[model samples]
Target: MPAPELAAVPGSQDPAPAETGTSRPTATSTGAPGGDAPLGFTGAGTGEVSSGSPDAAAVEEPAAPAEEAPPSTQDSPVGSEPAEGAPATREEVPTAAPTAPAATPAEPTATPAEPAGSAATTSEAAAPAESTAPADSAAPTDRAEPTDGAPSSEAAAPGEAAAPGEAAAASEAAAPTDGAAPTESPTPTPGPRPAPSPSPRPRPTPRRQVPTPAAVAPAAAAPSVVAPVDAHDAAEAAAWGRVDDDGTVYVREATGERVVGQYTGADTEEALGFYVRRFLDIQAQLALFEARLAQITPKEIDQTLATLTEALAEPAVVGNVDGLRERLEKLRSAAGERRKQAAAEREAARAQAVAERTVIVEKAEQIAEQDPARTQWKQSGQRLRDLLDEWKTAQRTGPRLDRPTEDKLWKRFSHARTAFDRHRRQYFSELDATQDQVKAAKEKLIARAESLSTSTEWGRTAATYRELMDEWKAAGRASRKDDDALWARFRAAQQKFFDARSAQNAEIDAEYGENLKAKLALLEQAEAILPVTDIKAAKAALRPIQDKWDEAGKVPRADVQRVEGRMRAVEQAVRDAEQAAWKRSNPETKARAEGAAAQLESAIAQLEEDLAKARNGGDAKQIADAEAALEARRTWLDQVQRAVHE
Candidate 1:
């Protein structure tokens, strides 16, 4: 049974060859079709045009026929190609027929397929065998099976080239179709379509590692139709590159297509990956740069940006170069902002550092201004050093200070330190001189005290020594070394004086002990003269005793009162005896008694003679006068006699 056939619609000229110079894009194969390989081009565009301008190719060209006619409807399977010699009606033609390549019969030799992807593409290229004829064959039905179902445009008539847009339109039209059942051609045997060059399975584009800017979202990964890749991503990757089976890698840019590098002995996918990795490296560097925007210095960022810019300008890899350039531009703009921010922060930090350093300097000056005499030397010195240390720390770790300001602060601090040092030295020197003078004065006082210590003039010498001690107290202190020695010498002299005075007192008391005994014995002997009967004898004994008592040496002070009291009692007794003797032996009393006795005797004789004469004459008056005189005489005489007898 001959395969089912379609009748030819006659009267149609063989379709004009696809416009000359029109190139068709073939899809780069990633792997065997079963495990998610991208389907080839489904159909052709409505018309033929050059491969250069894609926008013009998208317009509908309903009047244009298939570029290449099918096997004269005799041999073609039903619905395989349009009827021979007759323009195929739109209803009868397969949906993909519009975008099919030229089917002209005049030239049977097939043109070599163009590279897999195009410059300005919105979709994946058609598969290799899907779009291109295997070899020179007259019928569209004789082309490779399992194809994009688009007719060849590379088979266009000579001298009839269309616009560059034909390629893009044809590329879009190269979508695969479900219209015709896959059937082997029965006409001239065509060469078998070249097996799709093996290619490395493309890895899914990884998410960028850089954090998104506060104002921007993360860039999406390049869309691809490769395994484990999206259709959009596949189309995007195709726009940048297409690696050949021969290990050549090509990069397409807005500027133009160029060979970036090669990876010999490597599969198309590996080679492409090798170049793509270089592009990824650029991206990684960009991500790292963005991440470091806040961490690194602005100058460093500028240097790194220069390096990255250079690398991106003529990179060694093949990828979405225009997109990468755009991303770099964004990074450049961000870097400029980051640089400004970093500079501002540094300036602020420097200002703070200057303020801190100024504080340290001022503190040092304050310490230096304190009075040297009252200043705590140890504590003040340590504080100054600590301030200096703080200044050094700020200098080491903080922002650099301007030279003039730093030098001015340092000069003030240094002057303060120098002033303090000079003051300390001068103060200590004067103190040393004063201490020396004090030491000398104390030595003289000690010598004077020592001289007084040995002198026997106890009362006067002790007074002199006391005066010396008072002088020592008035003397100011010396250094500890000299003051202690001076004090020891002075105290020894004072102790010596007191000890000698005590020894002299002890000797005097011993000598006075004998005197006390002698006085006591004399006192007893003198007391025996009390109650004197013979005043002369008592006086004689008392006088010898009194003399002996006087001869006795000074008595002890405790016995002086007792001995003197006994001597006083003996003297009083002798005095009473002397007064009694003087009363008995009075001379005036004897004289008066003798004279009265003589006179009375004479008178009594005279009176008696007179009385006899008168009695004879009988003269009574005369007798009476004589008689009265004789009586008075007798009384005077009797009294005198009594005195002599007593």
Candidate 2:
């Protein structure tokens, strides 16, 4: 069998001693005896790396001389035995360090001693075969030096002797592989042992290695271990992430599972809880965004979506990553729909605002169109102001209107107001002109009334006052402020004239009061001549009384009716008396009376004779006839006697 290969342990090197005229061995095969296997390492460098060290290619560059490192605990026996029954002394050596001095070929090579009990297991052939080789004969054989970080195959354990059969096989295998002889080492010559130097043993430097159970001995030290997960936590982890026994953490996604983090502390539950909380935070943000979709603008929501998408792209949290992506996509769609709806609402509001503003403008226009003469100016003006206020309010509270629409409405409103104001000014101007004319006419009438008010010519002045009042009535009304003052002055002047007339009439009434008594006395005298026995005397008396009544003239107005009525009655009586006297004095009337009286007297005398006859005869029929005749004659005779007496 060929010699077993020996590789240097990580952080350690076995150096070759330098010798004069020694040739370095050339390696026919750097590969392992078996076919080289692939080590499936994907991180920190190339393939085929040792478990304890990096690949040789990574450190092939020449390095500066380094301090020797302590021997690795990984080195093991290569020839299968240790030398001289003493444990080998292991010293630290650094890889790529400068060489130490080698033992001289003339003297025996000093090998590390071996443990006493271990040497007994060796084959007895190993000792004799090692003792046969001459040290000087070995000088011609090439010694293999490690180069290009290649491992040395023939290296043996310190103080270990090789197996004779394997040494022969190695020599046979090396014969044609290279034209060099087999290397030989001289057997050690037994001699008195030299005493070890009195140097204190070096203390072992603590080596860093994979922690074992003993490493947790410190009171404060704790081991890194994954906590046992409950069923609920296990389910949660199945949905969110997976925890490996080595504390590696993975997040599950649709694409596949991916390494996200690791748990370095003892508790795996806390580590998983931390990542779960991060997922909850992200979920909370998404829920809040969904709720406020209407409040935030489309542009703002789009920006938030972009930010969230980027944040979730390579999420820090452990959860259903594919589910989160689906949720975000739905949110984006919802936001898009909301943006479209918002746009529609804005358009509708703008249209409504325009319609409302138009209505206000039309109302103002209608108010302005009303004729100022017929319009209730106060109410109309107030309505216009209210319409303007309404317009301003709509602008403030309603949606924004397009500029052209707003401007057009404003123009109409302004024009209406301007027209209304112009009409109002014109109407007041005409009213003022009319008032001026009326005031002029009233002033002239007032002046004329004052001129006639104090005149004492009662009849003429009264007529002039009546004429002035008629003129005042014909004059149009002035403004109330001027009219009231002018009217007061005119009325006072007229009152003065009427008051003077009343006083004058009162004084005349007192003067005529005595005349009323004299006229009453004269009326009594005239009334006394009623039964006129002497016509000429009655006439003469009445003539004088009538003349005196005329002289009495005007009486007090209260007494005029009584006195004049009495005097009229007396005049009617006197006329009736004169008619009677005339009848008595008239020739025709007297003749008619004398003839009737004479006829009645003759009839009476005849009837008296007939009556005497009837009385002497005592015949009833004849006597009744004679008596009726006699009564009729007596009645006629009495009427004739009265007429004759008159």
lDDT of each: 0.50, 0.50
What are the TM-scores, per candidate, against the unseen true structure? Answer: 0.42, 0.43
lDDT of 1 by residue, 430-523 (tens): 9999999999899889888877778888888878877887888799899998899989988898888789878777777788888878877777
Q: How many clashes (backbone atoms < 3 Å, residues ≥3 apart in a chain or on different chains) does model 2 have? A: 12
Stretches of candidate 2 exceeding 4 Å from the true structure: 1-238, 243-250, 258-266, 292-313, 376-379, 457-478, 502-646
Residues 1-646, candidate 2, lDDT per residue (tens digit)? 1111111101101112222222111100011111011110111000111111111111010101112121112111221111211111112111221122222111111111111111111111111101112111111101222232222111211112332223222322332111112222223222222243253221111122111213212210112121222445334644678666644556778888765543322245544543454455456567788899889987889877875675466553467767767888999999989999988998998988888888988898898899777988889999999998999899999998889889999999999999999888898799799889988888888788888877899999898888888888888777889889989988998998899888888899899988988997887788788777777888898998999999987987677788889888877877887787777777787678789988988887887888788889887888899889878878877886787667
**Model 1 / residue 569 / CA error / Å:** 30
Worst 10 residues of 2 by lDDT: 37-46
* TM-score computed on alpha carbons, candidate 2: 0.43
How much is the lDDT of residue 498 in candidate 2?
A: 95
Clashes of 1: 39
